[model samples]
Target: MNLFELNQAYRELEERDDLDLETLKDTLDAIEGAREVKLDSLASWIEKNKMQIDWVTEKVKDLQAKKASLTNLNKSLQGYMTQSLDDAGIKELQTKNHILKPRNYKASVVVDSLDDLPEEFKQTKTEVTADKKELYKVLKDGQEVPGVHLKPNRGTVIK
Candidate 1:
């Protein structure tokens, strides 16, 4: 039976609080039979569509790899084109289908190490963070630090 029909049946069952043992058993048996039919239909549908699912999964992986390859190629070509334009003293090149020009971007600062910077040239930004791995190690060694505590977490494994 469909969900609506099953729900109506359940509602009828719920209203009859004085149902005899035989009547309750029959109702339960009907519900279980309907559930088994639904499960069988679902399993059959999945089996029929398994091949299409596998094909789509493979195509997605292939497209992702191709996208990564194209991205790398674009970066390489952009660098080479930029160098060629700079060397040839051409600022911009326009064609019917495309326009090639150099776009200026903000320069980025590269630092070797934060510790090597002199105090005067460096700005200090303090951020407090908990090192969970180190904390776990300390707790495992039977030691506790102030302001830190371990808590148990529970989860269900569905398999």
Candidate 2:
């Protein structure tokens, strides 16, 4: 029987005063054993999924590293081609299937040091955040915080 049905049967057995001692004990033991088996099965399923997640996480990291390397290589190749074209004094080259030309990009400001930046050129940002650690300490000591309260949570740990 499933865990829920087994639990119901066990409860029903408790309310019955007509069963003999031996029969009552045996029935409860059987229900308990069934529940144990169901729990073990569920825990095994959780463990299997966790293993798959770890494997996929590692694969994703490897793929990201490979992509970054390929992107850097592409930038290097483009820079080399641009340099070659400029050295050859060619404004544009027309091939059988493609036309390659150097184009000017819009000018961008480069910052070498933040310390040297003028006050007018710098931007200030302000952020507000909750201090959960301090909140926890205050709440545990029977203090009150407006619009905030400690919440109780439960989690299962499998080992």
Error of 2 at 46 (Å): 1.6
* Best candidate, TM-score: 2
Per-residue lDDT over 34-133 for candidate 2, one digit per residue giving the tens place of the 0 to 100 score: 5566456446656777998999999999999999999999999999988989999989999899898977789889999999999899999999999999
User: Which lDDT tens digits does candidate 1 get at residues 1-159?
Assistant: 677776566656656769898987776676744665544444544454576799999999999999999999999999999998889888899979989998778997899998998889888789999999999999879897999888888953322
Clashing pairs in 1: none
TM-score of each: 0.42, 0.70
**Candidate 1 ranges beyond 4 A from true positions:** 1-39, 108-159
TM-score, prediction 1: 0.42
